[model samples]
Target: MSRIQCPRCQRPQSHCLCPLIPCLDSRTRVLLLQHPSEVNHALNTARLAALGLNNAELIVGEVFEDLPRLLNQPGYRARLLFPADDAQPIQTYGASDEPLLLVVPDGTWRKARKILHLNPLLAALPRVTLADGGVSRYRLRKAPGPGALSTVEAIVQALQVLEAPVSFEPLLRPFEALIEGQIAAMGEETFRRNHAGK
Candidate 1:
């Protein structure tokens, strides 16, 4: 049997394309507040998103404990990148904004609820949700709806929204290569079998 691990989480190198992690160069900083449970999961997109951004920080813990300090970090105009629900619209940052995009990746619905229940600090920061509808690239995890987006995609969208000229295409390219590596390591049948049920 081939011994490979998921590229993203590096868990025994399963059929995970996470190793195809992308690196991005942008002015806007990204801070990923990941749930501790997702740290090693093959399908966790927050980890992948962190790899893509140059100014990104991945903190694994409960949101309440982990996010406040990062927000208090020097020189970051922090904003929570959640969905643009009717109840909350995108709060605008200044033209000369020192932007920080805080991404919560425990899946969309769970993340939304997490912020609602645990993150009082997050509420105080500017909130910006995506209005342009799209689907998530994280096939291993199910989204809350059709418009739900993956962490990487969400970052790309956020960058675009800020008019930052960061190249997201390069970030996506590695994902396919990683997927191919995963398939090669696991054999197509086994890989498909394992992922199909999820």
Candidate 2:
């Protein structure tokens, strides 16, 4: 019989401790425009971040068709959260500042590029990149570059850039546990395979 999967981690639900996921108190609003393919991914970090933050909105779709009108309705500022290369610098948020828009395009390198190209509205937003000198915890997926950070990690760094408090730190702690749990599950699967061969 196949091993039971963890409902939270989707690994072997027995090993999933996603319930331990931390919540964050943030003033800056986070808008996650994720691809539909990424919504159900077990390794997707955007979902984790959304779960942690109170002002986070995760929209899984092909385009930002009605997004602009929605933003116009209430307190919302639009900004694209991509790499800050030669494009533009990350903006700073003030105490009475408008909502900081964080558009995280979730997918593989090719898929992400497609998401950007296909969505003109998102492409038109002010692009801001993260400048963290740390490695990514998204071991399951290969990054396009050294600066390629996961959605959650990118948000944390962005929050720091905006001078938000350490309230977001707690949101990242479970990520380490999530990675460790995944690695352990993989090891267990490998051990079982080897034993069966023997």
Candidate 3:
């Protein structure tokens, strides 16, 4: 029989980490523009990030037609989380009554670019990139570019800068759980050998 998968986190029953998900109330609105191909990827962190945050939303598509409407709503400023040459560091944006709408594209660099190009609203949004942090802890997938970050890491860093630092660390609980579980399953010797670079 096939293993039962948890619909929420999409991990198998024994490996499910939903119970560790954090409940965070964010002042900013986070919307994940995910590639359809990333939906079932074992290493995908966008869904987990969304699940942890109360104000987060996940939309799977290459071209989101409603993006413009969402942006035009009152009392919110929209910014795309991407590294364009013109993108300013996210830390520069201080607190405000105008809530922030952070649109993060979750996929390969090429796919993310496709999403940006296909949607004029996405392309036109002000771009903001995260501050440089340590290397990624994701051993299951490869990052696509210089200074790349996992989707979850990006969200955490953004929350730390935009919200409170304490507000985002709780979300890392399940993320660490996922990594630990995978390491155990892979065995010490194999995990050490494979993760030498991480």
Instruction: Judging by TM-score against the true structure, name the best candidate.
Output: 3
Best by lDDT: 3
Report the lDDT tens digits of candidate 3 across residue range 72-146.
656678888988899988763455547688889999888888888898778888998888654676665556555
Off by over 4 Å in 2: 1-12, 84-86, 188-198
Candidate 2 lDDT, 1-198, residue by residue in tens: 988876544545665656767766676778777888886676667777887787787778776688666455366667777754555666567667876656677766667778878877767777877765657766655666676777788888888777544546767866767766666767966645543223
The lDDT per prediction is: 0.62, 0.70, 0.82
For model 3, the superposed segments whose C-alpha errors exceed 4 Å read: 92-97, 142-146
Q: Candidate 2 vs candidate 3: which has greater TM-score?
A: 3
Residue by residue across 1-198, what tens digits does model 1's lDDT show?
857765545646544444456556776777777767667654456666677777787777665565666777677666677654432443335677665655444544665557546777776565677765675555544565776776667766667656544356666655545555556767878867776545
**What value does the lDDT take at residue 148 in candidate 2?**
76
Each model's total of backbone clashes: 12, 5, 0
